[model samples]
Target chain A: MVKPETLHAVLNAKTVSVVGASSNPDKTGYQVLKNILDAGYQGRIYPINLKAESILDINCYPSLLDVPEDLDLVVIVVPAAAVPEVMQQAADKNARGAVIISGGFREIGNVELENEVMGIANAHDIAVIGPNCQGINYTPNKLCACWPLLTKRGGMAVIAQSGTIGATMGGWAEDEEIGFSALLALGNKSGVGEIELLDYFASDEETKVIALNIEGVKDGRAFIKTAKSALSKKPVVVLKPGRTRKGAEAAQSHTKSIAGSDKVFEAVCKQTGLIRAEGICEFYDYSKILSMLDAPLGRRMLVITSSGGSGILAADTAEDLGIELKQLSTDIKDRLKEILPNQCVVSNPLDLTGDATANRYMQALDVAITSEVIDCILVIFGDPVHKASDVVRDISSRTDKPIVVAFLGGGDVEKEEVLLMHQAGIPAFPTPERAVRAIGALLKKKNY
Target chain B: MHKLIGKALADEYHLNEAEAWELFSDYGIPTPQHQLARSVEEALDAAKRIGYPVVMKIVSRNILHKSDAGGVEVNIMDDEGLSEAYHAIIENVLAYKSDAVIDGILVCEMLKGGLECIIGMTQDASFGPTLMFGLGGIFVEVLEDVSFRVLPLSKEDALSMIYEIKASSLLQGARGQVARDVDAMAELMLKVAIMIEDNPEIKELDINPCFVFEAGGGIMPVDARVML
Candidate 1:
């Protein structure tokens, strides 16, 4: 375990300095300085550039020694060969932490570079984030230490080994309107890796869910321990990229990482209660659902659909995916039978048949959701003829049970209904399979 | 049961073919019909009664690995070979076990070739009574491909064990070879596991070359050894 004082100084530092800050806006150093100011961080920002006296209307210092007071953190955005000297200067200035947002270190297939970078960080007694990274972002603290374009909020702590993937996830989070507590691009992971970030997030009161996009894991045992501890507090969703042999080799070459056997990793995930997402989209999609909705108590799914064919397809998919099509009790079935014609299928899937209105959809949901046998309910709107927004509002106001809405068509129903449902705290997916998979993941997490 | 033999009841014992068959009958493992012979006359008589193309071996309590010690003689066709083999067996058995008591000889019908396999049981420290199944014969150790399940396994458990081994694909008709009777093998392994679990005093048991014939033909235990 890292010391609490050290962890605090690294995560909650007040003052920050940008070493190797450039006057050129095209350089990464200038972008780092601009992002910090744009995020409205309350900390003092000092840009250190030897050639220029001032950059971005802030007076620039020639070196770390020229800084007058104790600096809390230093952001290094210089070339890989010049990092050792800059780190030596940060050590002299006693900076608490440093974020190395430059590439061409150990990730460039050089062992000597990795050793030198680690040596510098160790001698300085400073915790480093990355050598080839896109820095960190803490929304609540107004700390935008990354170069990615994103709007920060407080819900999840996103950790990724690849900077590009982390930036992409940030973009997705912004577009999806899901807030994030912290986003860390753990490039190269020479000093600090997922285990440290996981430990930090395990006790963080602001973080609700941890979304990780990993190409490979360094230590399996430590990961299992940290993940087990974190999952006990909050849900930990992982999207491991190198599942196949070819993918594992590619990941090894890309990050100098070791990818373990996929079967063993799957078994570990099952044993440790870490939810494994299928793809990149599902990774974010499931995280959104888990964060926004309540966990279903059981696998008994009650799907209410307007189209009979869609209802049957949903039923078949549920059965194939090990989800039980819950049989509505006698009272609920009798009520549905009285409300509908004799030709309607009044069993588990409760098909409303064609030519259904908003009131009929609400009636089916009310009847299915009140039953004691059903654990979750899926409402599929097939080519909505009535006002879709009105039906969504009525369904959202009615029940507190976990509901996933699937919009079949492509027009306003998909765009408007999904937004209304999302805003109402109910997650909506485009297809029933995705919704079912997300609900299944939530149920598994709940039992775990 | 012909009073069996004195060595068959000893604390440390080895049985010849006829005595081993009697012991196998006692344990409910089937063995081929055979007879024992003492001299050249008895050898010829046993051969004629058991039919032609019989296998002969020198039988002694002290000599367990008969083939390694040159005590086994196979496919004796007629009286001339039987006469020469009788003297050869005596010489070999006497040379192999000079100080021990010797049984005369074993003459039995030759078994046809089939898919060979091994089934055995050993007490694991963590989980007791581990049953093992693998491809048998000389290649058993070389291949080192095997599967184990806890003792007293059900038929389903036995079938799962067979499918668990890495080389199980070979038994499932790999390389255009005929598939063996795996169901029969599973049943036999389950029975053996149950027997071992029931009789805890028996420390180790090996049924090597449990020849499993092609489809529709059942498996049979050709040779077995047990230790307490």
Candidate 2:
């Protein structure tokens, strides 16, 4: 294991040195420096460049070794040929962590230089993230240590092998208002892999859910073991692409050879208790819901929709997604009848019918949550959006039962309602299927 | 397993199907009443001792696919019939594989009408030993109806793998036919798993057409291939 202090310094470092810090805005070095400053990182920043005396008004050192103070973390944006020397110097100076955003080496059919860097990092116990990738966005200290972007502080943590994919998830989470505690781009995994980062997040107080998107791993057994341990602490939802990926071509044994990529990974995921999502929409939606609420105790779902068509659609989707549409007791159904529209009829889906108000939605939420029959609630509104902020606020502040929404309306007010629901920490979907899918994800998590 | 593998490797036989039966029997895989005879006279004597209506197959290092190579003969009722089958199998295999070195003959009681099942094991690069359970037939690959599971499996995993295939209903007694012994099959799977779990050298194992009789009638392995 890498030193705990080194990982601590890497994650919560107070002083950073951006190696090969460029003055030009077009280069990644300049952007990384600019992002750190823009993100309002309170730590000291030391930009190292051979020529530049200052970058973004911060005084620059000519070399990492030339920096007068001990460094916590170093971000290397130098050329590939120069990375080995830079890593050696960082190791010599006892730097805690280094994020090498430089490209080349293994991706370009050369691994000697990468191996050299790994040797030095291991000898010195420095936690290195990447040498051929993007960077990391740690919001706890506003450490925008990679590409310049808008990252927020919350529960979900995104860890990916691709920098672009990491950035894409970061941007998606930000767009969806899904707060994240950290966004780490695991480039090449030369020195550090997902298991370490998962270990970090497993105990991270800021992180409640982990959204992992990995194509493959160098050590699958280790990955499974670490993921299993992490699942015991917090939910680890994964999206391993390349499902059609076959095994090594030499299939001398038919039984082993026929073990397709999808089947193996599916079984591994099932065995290790990781929630493997289907698509991007499912990825973030499930991450958000799992982060905010505990998995429901059962598959029983109480879906309340304004339109009967949507109610029926949700009922069908609920069944397909493995969520049981619970039949409300007569007393609860009668109480719902008294509170709901007089023309309404109470059933499993519990249609509120057209012209239902946001007030009715909130009342139905209260009734179902109070009843012990249902494990979760799915609120779907078809049209005529009203002030849903109060409804979402009540759901968030009231009973601890998990709630998801499917706002199928299209208008300015409806968009505002969806946005409000997101802001209030309730996962609101654009369709009933997505909402049911989120609940279904919750159901799957319960199996663990 | 090491002892068996050690002896197979010493003999320079990549897979000794006859040796595989003993290993299988030691691990709870039942085999029919059988004996190995190195000559025609010994083959007839063993057949007589076992009772007539027996099966004989040419056990040779050169023959891998027995039926396709004309190395097997069944339903021999007397010494004359056994004597005839013995020379015919040797001649047929000699013509099929001119350089084939004979390793005596395997004589066993001919099984009655029963269901056929296939249980196999192979080493996976990632997950180590994995087991495949399916109905025995030539259509295993053609129909792609087999169910596989990685080893170190629980009883539930074994049973689930058995029930996962399309032929599970057939094993459960389709039409008015008697049901095949599922617990027996599950035990066989678990036994194979434990065997492979200890011996990594057994790279691939195939026991095709294991005649499974009615419920609790017990199953018997007809042929096996253990590749190291």
Candidate 3:
């Protein structure tokens, strides 16, 4: 069982101490402290520095023991040798958690030093995030321990082994206005790692979906077990790199020749119900779609479009991904034909033609949303259509069925309308194929 | 089973061919009927009992790849053929490894025609035991077309792993060929899973060219190699 209190304190700490606080703006120490202040964290902040009287306009303490009260969390950004001393001082101050954002431990042939830090943290009941990492960001509490302040709070949490990947995903979310609940960078993993973080995020009410970037796992069975339990509550999207590394270089048998770590990791994903993303784009795409909408009841899909070419592209991808583009019954087709234009075709991808209007889409959605045969709907906007976002938002609100929209070929209109659709709680894509692929993530095959 | 594995680990690096077959038979995994012979007379008698068109293989503790070591002879028709093949196998084994201890020869019925497949188990650093399935021969060796599942698999998992490979259409009777026995294949996979689950000491195992007969014809493990 995972004790949530330890991580809870770290994410929602009421009192935090930044050891190695710097007066210089060029150092990481200064940047982290500045980010925490910039995020408008309501918690009491303390900067520990022996040489400086104050950092970031906050009074400094010579050591953690010099603080007047107990600390909930400690942000350690000192040199390698000084980390253990700061940790000891934190233990004396009864700090419950610490995020050690320092290097020169375990990663660069310094095994004994990393082990010493782990021993101290374990003995003192301190849940350390890293000995060498890029810090953390929990937006809900306004705690940005990370260097670059990112505070767009949403439903997705990003946990990455590489700090750059974590920041990249966070930046992408901010650019798209997708937002995130938390962004954790795990480096060296000297203490806490993905397993513990997964357990913590699985129960976090703010995190509806999890995006994990893993290089490798230490314990295979434990990872599978934890991932399985976490998946029971929320969807997990994993992006694992180095898929082509030869784990069978010295294999002696036919079976061993083909058995690689990547293959086993793929098996792990299948067994645990974790969505394995093939690349970084798919990782973010899957995470966004899953967090935004409830999974469709079945694979039966209906594509509505204004252009035949974009509709064809969506249909091809849907077929490749095992999503069925079901044909409409004559009765339903006749109903759609009565409301649509003469050039409109009442088929799957129910093309509304080049002269399509918002009313045409509203009418088409009225018929498709009520059809029992259609499980999901994909609306492709190939040309600029007026007030289309309002039509989609109104239609989507009436039913619980998932609706994905693709805004294309309209240039500025596409950009503005896509943002509006997203604001109205609709998943909007820039291309038809991408919208279909996002739908595919929800209906992946179950190995069990 | 414990005693056999214990003796193999105590004396040699892996289980000899005869011991591996015995282990498979004990677990109810179907293999071609065979017997181990210590001498020429025993080889001739074993061939007579198993019938004509038999295959002979040299069982040695030193040689792991029997085919590569020239320790296998197939297509024996009668007594003269068995006699010549048995002597040739011993000569080849001796040539391959001068200090190898010959543990008799395995004489068995030669499996004729079927869709060739391979089932195997290998230890993963993080995942422990992982099972693999793919088409036999060049398919597994060159194309590297295979699907894997962790140990302790369900019936659905077994069936899916078998069909996950790109060449699975062959098992469904591609181009005018008769469909292979997929049910038996899934059952065989389950049995292998159970066997490995029960015996964690097995570091690796390979059943190459496992013949998948036509529907309702069942399956047979033609060659098995077990490493401790």
Report per-candidate DockQ: 0.04, 0.26, 0.48
| Over 4 Å off, model 2 | A1-5, A245-260, A342-345, A370-372, A395-400, A446-448, B10-12, B49-53, B74-81, B111-115, B138-140, B166-180, B210-220
**Tens-digit lDDT track for model 1 on A1-448?**
3444665686676888998888788888888888888988888888898888999888889988888888878899988888888888888888878899988878777669767877877876788888888998877777887877565574778898877767777777766566678888888888778888888887887777888887777666677778878888888899888788899889889887776656556645655778898787788777777777768777888888777777777777788778898788888888998887666788867787777777887667766767888777888777654565566567657766678877676366567666666666677777777777777777766632
Error at A384, model 2, angstroms: 4.7
TM-score of every model versus the real structure: 0.66, 0.90, 0.94
Candidate 3 C-alpha error for residue B72, in Å: 1.6
Give candidate 1 misplaced runs (Cα > 4 Å).
Answer: A1-8, A307-313, A337-345, A353-357, A384-400, B1-228
How much lDDT does each candidate structure score?
0.76, 0.80, 0.86
Q: Give the C-alpha miss distance for residue B15 in model 3, angstroms.
A: 0.4
lDDT of 2 by residue, A298-378 (tens): 888888888788888898888887788878988898888888878776888888788888888888877777888888788
**Model 3 CAPRI quality:** acceptable
> DockQ winner among the candidates?
3
lDDT of 3 by residue, A1-448 (tens): 2258888888899999899889999998999999999998999999999989998789998988889999998999999888888888889988888899998887777778888888888898898887788999999999999867787888889998778889888887776777899999888766678899898899999998999987777778788888988888899999877676442343212111223388888988877888988888888888888878888889999999998999999999999999999999888998998888789988897999989988889999998898888888999998988788999999999987889998899888888888788777788888888899999886652221
Model 2: per-residue Cα lDDT at residue B157: 75
Pairs that clash in candidate 1: none
